[model samples]
Target chain A: MTWDWAISVLGILAGLCTTGSFVPQVVKAWRDGETRAISTRMYVIISVAFVSWLGYGLVIRSWPIVIFNVLNLGLSGVILFLKLRSAPPRRKEA
Target chain B: MTWDWAISVLGILAGLCTTGSFVPQVVKAWRDGETRAISTRMYVIISVAFVSWLGYGLVIRSWPIVIFNVLNLGLSGVILFLKLRSAPPRRKEA
Candidate 1:
């Protein structure tokens, strides 16, 4: 196969697999209604990174990069939202 | 700023933030000495993705992409390693 074609195939396969890593976590969080294990800091940082990537993609006029990051950002945002929402209620004790 | 420069800036910023997402998880996994919260399947998938990204980067002759994904792949690999190592032992019950 041509180098470009080979790379494209590799890219598609790898992208799908790595991106899939987050799927189980999302499902678990959704199913059990608990996100205690999820880290808020992580989400915050990731959101920032994804936004940067989106900006980069836009600047370069690369639709694939932009679209992928946009979707990733959305997914990460959902996890962050759930994590924040599920924070344990603070208690006032005498 | 030129579009290329702008995109580069954005790429760096976003890359840092999104990549930061995995840090806490790694630290937590390390600290707790437990990877129960981590998903092996997720790691498997991400490793695949990172490889693809690397291939894409190489194909496109993008050094930044290639370097970044290589590092990301390594980081992801570490997590996958730990998760796999910490898998709970199966039990046979009467």
Candidate 2:
């Protein structure tokens, strides 16, 4: 296979894997009903970053980049929303 | 700014954030001495994926992609190594 074709295939796989990385966190948050461990600041920064990535993909017409970022943005948004809705992890009274 | 420059800037930010997403898990594993919650299969898959991504970046001559994937590869490798070396989470006897 030509080098470009090979790397393109790998790039697609990488995109899928990278996006898939978030699946576990989403599943855990949904099943456990807790997102207290995830930092709000991190989520906020990531969401903004994903949006920018999406914009970058749109500008470049890169479907892989666009699709992955779209999914990531949604995943992070859900986690952030859940974090906000869920109460903080229970603390023991001194 | 030209679209290329704008998107490039955004892409850099996205790469950083995407790579940064794994930091929390790495920190937790190191601090708490627990990686039982993470699936070995998942880490294996991600490490391979990161390697492929790095290769893809090299082929494409994308510095942002290369740097991000290299860092991610290292981080995931560390977590995987620690997971294997550390004892598994203790189970309560029934």
Candidate 3:
């Protein structure tokens, strides 16, 4: 019983750290209006991954996974949107 | 039994997507040597989170979590190192 509680606490803490970590990135991107150093591919892939994780969470009926992925999706989406928006338009080859 | 396989597949897929997503980011960061748009706070927090997750995985005896967190720690560390290295020297307050 006590071990279960400890495990649960650790899991929750880990989840919060991973999920909430994106908050600062989002804030920096939004505030600075800069994403030159940020990786578009990373966000793109992670966004898709979050969707998969969300599906997995739903199938497994794990609320923590579902919640974290939902939040992650939102955060990742914002960064991707900002990065894409700020990107320089590609020029056609002469 | 089949359902068990399906669940396992979904879990693996989700794990792969999240873990593999960082590859592009690392590649970009290495090639460009830029991290201005990235958030130091996010990486710092996520690095700590990865450690926590690693610990949790160990306690739970989950190989996937352990492996993923280890990979994440390495990836996140590189980005953090790049970001910090590229950071402009802080000016002392008057």
On TM-score, the candidate that comes out on top is 3
lDDT of 3 by residue, A1-94 (tens): 6999999999899889989999999999999999998888899889988999899899989999999999999999999999999999999899
Q: Report the poorest 10 consecutive residues by lDDT, candidate 2 chain B.
A: B34-43
Q: Where does candidate 1 chain A have its weakest 10-residue lDDT segment?
A: A11-20
Model 3 Cα lDDT, one tens digit per residue, B1-94: 6998998888878888888888888888889988888899999999999999999989999999899889989998988888888899999999
- Ranking by TM-score, best first? 3, 1, 2
Q: Give native contacts recovered, as a fraction, per prediction.
A: 0.79, 0.40, 0.85
Per-residue C-alpha lDDT of model 1 across residues A1-94, encoded as one tens digit per residue: 7776876667666655655667777776777777654567877887788788777778778886678777778877877877888898889897
- 1 or 2, which is superior by TM-score? 1
Q: How big is the positional error of residue B33 in model 3, measured in Å on the Cα after superposition? A: 1.2
| Pairs with steric clashes in candidate 1 | A14-B48, A14-B49, A15-B49, A17-B45, A18-B45, A18-B46, A18-B49, A21-B42, A49-B14, A49-B18
lDDT of 2 by residue, B1-94 (tens): 7867876777888878767867776776777776544545556777888988998988889888789989989988977887787745679999
lDDT pick, better of 1 and 2: 2
Residue pairs with colliding backbones in model 3 are none
Q: Is candidate 1 or candidate 3 better by TM-score?
A: 3
Best by DockQ: 3
lDDT score, candidate 1, position A5 = 82
Per-residue lDDT tens digits of candidate 1, residues B2-30? 76776576777666665667788777667
Off by over 4 Å in 3: none
Q: Which regions of candidate 1 fall more than 4 Å away from where they truly are?
A: A90-94, B92-94
Residue-pair clashes per candidate? 10, 0, 0
lDDT per residue for candidate 2 within A1-94, as digits (tens), equals: 7877887788889878867766776676777776544556556777887898898889889888888889979977987887777856678999
lDDT of 2 at A26: 68
